[model samples]
Target: MDEGCDGTGLCIDTGDGEFMEISLHSRNSFERKKNPSQDSGFEDRGSKSKKKGLSVSDFLTRNLFSRKAKESEDDAEQGWKLFGRIPPKQAPDKDPQQITQEFQNKLRSVAQPKNSKKSDIEVMSTTALILENRPQNLPTKDPEEAEKHRQQYEAMVEAARKKELKELKMKKKQKQQQLKNEDKVVCAAKRWTDEILPNWETMKSQKKTRELWWHGIPTNVQGRVWQLAFGNDLNVTNELYEICCSRADDRIRMTIESSEIYGNSETSSEPPSSKESSVELIKLDVSRTFPQLCIFQKGGPYYDLLHSLLGAYACYRPDVGYVQGMSFIAAVLLLNMDVADAFVCFANLLNRPCQVAFFRVDEELMKVYFHTFEEFFDENMPGLYSHFKKHKVTPDLYITEWIFALFSKSLPLDIACRVWDVFCRDGEEFLFRTALGILKMYEDLLLHMDFCNLVQLLTKIPEDISGDTLFKHIDTIRMNIDKKRFNQVLAVNKES
Candidate 1:
């Protein structure tokens, strides 16, 4: 027998010198010969009357052998597709089983050597045969469905981007709104300068003017408003400030020279007067005041201004003299106004009756203030009031520093300014009210704290307290201080 195969299918030869082809290319490869016995030289085994398709065993027997016995081994092997070009890739749409079976049959047709015995060939698994014969480019998913998923993912990303952009836009809009409110405040100040101040006797009595001051003096006009509030009743002027500053400079220079010569103690055997003590105190406290701000340190921008202001005030008012907390008041004023105006305001501020009594450490006036505050505290927040009494926590511990500095030390700078606004407008009564408001605001927290914690909390008040929230509680409090008694106490102290 002879055997060969082209890429299409197998071919075989029997001793009759004729060839038969079993084409596997497609259905067209199955065209029958006119006379099967003559054309392919195969004996016609089936009866002509039957005319049925060949069974697998009969088909194999007839197709495996042909009469082309003279064909060379190379020629026969040349048509064998098992050793030919790579198999065509299976079409993505073709039935997988049909393709697998086709390749399986094609792989089973290789010829054996003439000397070797023919053993049955065991065909490989359908998956292995298909993988070996077919190219590795089969599609794992439908093309249209993959495109749909890609578009969906892009849409989700775009939506997230839009959401992020929207949030940014809202934040920017809120910031713009804040700026607009600030502009309104600036515009209101302009009206105060151009319209209101010229007719102050009339404008001062108006409800609108009172309301404006209640909100705040705008930052640009704070110096003017402060000067207006405290008034230059003593006719203090730029020239007087210069003269006082000149006098102060001389005293400070002499003191420094004396300290160098006599090692800090005064050369005179007599005790140092308030004037001598004040100059040294002013120099010592200048660096310590507002140390965190850096503007009051030795080499700071406002250092000379603060030093000069305190020195001038101490020299300008030898009667009131300089106290421990005086620099805090002077420093706060210097921040808002020019040196001359700040000195004028500082003199008038300290001249206020309550300020005089407090700075002088008038025992009688302080007792009155402490007594009044205790009454207000008991009235406003009885629970916290009882707690403080139990712990021996008294107003003298905290309110003294608060009122002395006008809360410039106890509260945040901005909130202290708000307190100052009301203090300037409503007078010392608001100070007592503010103390009550603070106690009421932290009543719950204070009620639970022990003695040390209570003292610490009230003295070193936390910086995080909200000004708005505190004032909201403050507005609700209706404190009725005994103004007549406070005045009598302050007046009696001043006379002595």
Candidate 2:
């Protein structure tokens, strides 16, 4: 065992109570920058020059060597003394167990640093070599003591891990705030908002303000901004939504209660066009929508809000009625604004130029979307397009959810929110750009994936990545797409 071997970390006690080993992991809200200065602890280990900013004792502890290393004939070549391993001998006639217990006691007393500064990094890095050489368990397999040691080590490690997480999150938040401060959009949004939407209408009428949306909308104002962008003032009023809800409630009750008696069977998932069948389908799906999000849980007010919004839309637009994907769409809206506003937003999104065709039982327009996407995919990403085609994988199989739900189910919520910010600004065209952008961002990974693995990878929500990073990816690929070609495909598909 090394001089100060604790269960998890090697601790050194120079008779004083302070411990030399420190944990490297820390906590934060966002990922820390992966610069070499932040990630690795030790660098240039083989260099002959002395490590700067470390005391003599610190240097010796960092550069300690085993007997084999000390015996190297090249000691003169390295020009550094290597401490030989201690012999099997008594420590001043003291019991080894007492000394071991006292060493652990000293380590426990050594407090963790308040902040993880550069100096702390250097200190923590010194322990890296010991971490690799550290034993998994005590040589003595005393079950009880080993278990106790394991528990203590785990507790310490866990605490350090959590602290490290907090640090990383703080770093991420600071970076974002710094970036946000630099963004001129924040100033424009504030000025425009202070002037109110009436004054902003000057810009809107001229069709100049839509570009402000791609710059990032403040969270508090995004709902209203979207409302303004969509020209949705009707559902913003409470009375209108109330009327829709009243009418919808009656339709919903009748459809649900008489579902079995009517042609709309409870088990049927057939293409639903009638208000009654749509209501039945909506009821069946209401509980299942965003099941994991706390706000949309079974009995929450947000849950009731989702029901009201979707139901109101069903009554308001009996032609489209309730669709399978509308629940997630409605959920996203309710998250952004009040139930009434969300309804208006939902209605506007569905009513956009050709989007309503997506819900038709025939699915003819949805097929157009899929076909156009495949065409664009071929033109832009020929390699991935060929791979997907070879495996008989089509956009209709997976992209239906993405298109209908505005990618609510496909991306992490943060990334999805950022996508929505741009989607509202750019209109329906942005959706395809984003879809292709996502593909382009991970093209290398996609190229290596098998068909089933590719499907799984595409469908699963990725881990919490920085939203700014994804938007950067979206922005890069968004410019490369030929809008002229896209319009041509749309025209051809619509004509067909």
Candidate 3:
């Protein structure tokens, strides 16, 4: 057993081998307090008792030796230091049971009341009412009032749900009716194919190989023959010739005169007719003829449906205005599908995100194709650029028509149809592949010739890239280029 002195000089017996020693100064101070010392050897006992009772020497010794004494002295010094030389009054000691009881009473004051007027069932119903109706002021104390409020709220919710369901049903029925009407229109438009005299397949296969002989017709008979053949017909072919003859404007006349001279002449010495002549003639006729043909002059259901669709498109896109290139694309479609179906294909092509961007008047979108080609040229044929620069041949002169018309004017009819078949299926990537094919076809000529000769060679390329050789080259290029990778490059260019 160990005896330990607490700060107040009370001895406690700790049942252990360890002994806690108290300082002599602490023991003396306690004795003096309990039973005053007879000797005045303790300096100024009256004032000392009044002033914390420990001398500077006793304070130092207690702090050094006794744990309990040191703690008490430290507390006292801290208190006086906080109070600026005057010691603070010590708090009186409280019983542990008394403190616990006081804390419990305070907790009870803040706690929610257990004896609520509402029953558990009523409380739950009232909570639902609060959620449903959400009244600003609620009667929490009376269960009957809360129950009545909850019943009213539930009735209101049921009414709202019924009304919403009714409205939803009405909208769904209306949408179904609209879809039925749209189906009727589509079916009516589709019926014209069955009603028409010749189906698209028969019309596509129709052969009219009438050849006009100007063989024995003298130079003087030429003008007369032209007037007789073209004069009576108000169709596109004659009207375009009439317009060409009437234009007398130097450039237009020269283009027409050159077309007639080279087109009709069998001479070996003269330069061959420019491909532009046939294109210009076709452009004139398409611009003039299609609008009148679309008037349904024959007055049949097939004509009406065909006219409506083609007319609507022509009216919608007046800038393009029924161009000759579209006629080729449309003619190909009209081979497999009825007019209405062909129109749908044409409309989808024009409206689709990939193709629509190419036909804008600003021509800004076509720059992507041009830029892609520039990259291709720089990478694959660096010498081509040097040659182009040397010859001062702008890409715009040749590529503009090639891309815009999809080479419809440049290629013969049969070849153009084959190219368009792939083009419609694959989208704009086919155009690049086709261009690469053209370049590769002429690679031998391109590599051997200088800039001036290159331009002349390319000018003759339209006639050269005519047959199975061209298709083979196009197929080879398509196989070589990863279209998905090219599309990704295009997407990135669009974002930038």
Candidate 4:
């Protein structure tokens, strides 16, 4: 027996019986041939049969192996997954020419008509790979590929440049339109100041003593009375009366009356009083204190009319009754138009559901506003709240004045006017943005200070900053907040 032969009987020797014989167990055994070649063909046929039998198994194994290989390749190809999804790669640091060309190609590919959807992944991967493989610090050789890239780049850049120019022009046009709108408002204000108001003065001055006296007396100044006694067409004036009567308190009324009686037309030779009498006397000069024509003034139909309207409004909306801040807002409107016109604007402002809801004292919309502020503070300036807590400063302490007066006391008149402009145009979002703007404006102080210092710094903020500066800062802050809030809202809506 040869060394290769098993103990089984299936062994065969070559010509001289010198060659080793190997054997395997056979399922069937029959002695057929003595020559090895004659038997070798039989073995070959049997091997071929065995191979044919394994065809399905081999196919399955190879299929699995290929699938595993492909999966491994995909994992390797994909860079690190961010938040369980692959994020778009940042554009590679590349020559401007190359970037422009690549960008153009991408745009062109996007523009190409295709029956099948192209995978964004494939396009991005190819672009990234191309950029990655590109040799850095290569000499400027004008290869055709490079030239093609250059042309594409040039085309894209030209397109982009044109788009930017178009956008700039649109923005310029929009800005011009805005300026025109503002100019119209200012012109209206000036017209009211120069023409409409002076005419009211003439009308009031021309009235009989009894009519003047009757108008001067502030009692029974109801909206209906305003409509009946004043110009019948004075809807704005009547609305103002309604709002004033609805919202006013005794203090505001007394102040307005006093201001009207003690006109500030003359230089004061005597020192003003410091007591409550002084307050009353100061109220008598209401026209001087809350100037701009609509709130308080003596001897003018506009004044009497507005006084009546606002007085009525104070009475009508007693929950917000007599906030000192309303007068300032009213005054701004009055400066811009006739009392009737100003009242209509004010009505539009206050009658809005949001403003009306906010003004309800029992409902305490201010609290909701403070909650929004607290949330903002927590997210953007987390330390501020903790600092405030450490310093024992409640939300009411600072936020009350800011919210109640809409920062009238904190911000200068002009800036407050701009805020009101946006507030009127946009709505409640403007208020939050304004608050954020205030915080951001004091960002330097906010960044450096701990809680105690934060409180102190906020408390000590000067009231003298330019309104323009304040508005500009507020606009910037508001823009950021608007963008973030818009995205958040959009995401939430999408999820829903």
Cα lDDT of model 1 by residue, 180-237, tens digit: 9789898888978887777877887689888787777777777777777778788888
| Model 2 per-residue lDDT tens digits across residues 183-202 | 76667767558754667556
What lDDT would candidate 3 get against the real structure? 0.48
* lDDT per residue (tens digit) for residues 339-455 in model 4: 655666665566654456555543555455555566666655566556666666666666555655556555666566556545543456667667766776777666666667666
Candidate 1 lDDT score at position 325: 80
Off by over 4 Å in 1: 1-177, 269-276, 481-496
**Ten-residue stretch with the least lDDT total in model 1:** 122-131
Candidate 3: deviation at residue 1, Å?
A: 99
Cα lDDT, all candidates: 0.72, 0.66, 0.48, 0.50
Rank candidates by lDDT, best first.
1, 2, 4, 3
Better by TM-score, candidate 4 or 1: 1
| Stretches of model 4 off by over 4 angstroms after superposition | 1-306, 318-320, 447-461, 475-496
Which regions in candidate 3 have their CA more than 4 angstroms from the true location?
A: 1-283, 287-310, 318-324, 448-466, 478-484
TM-score for predicted model 2 compared with the true structure: 0.60
lDDT of 2 at 429: 76
Clashing pairs in 1: 5-79, 12-66, 13-66, 14-66, 14-67, 17-67, 18-67
| Model 3 TM | 0.36
Alpha carbon deviation, residue 44, candidate 2 (Å): 94
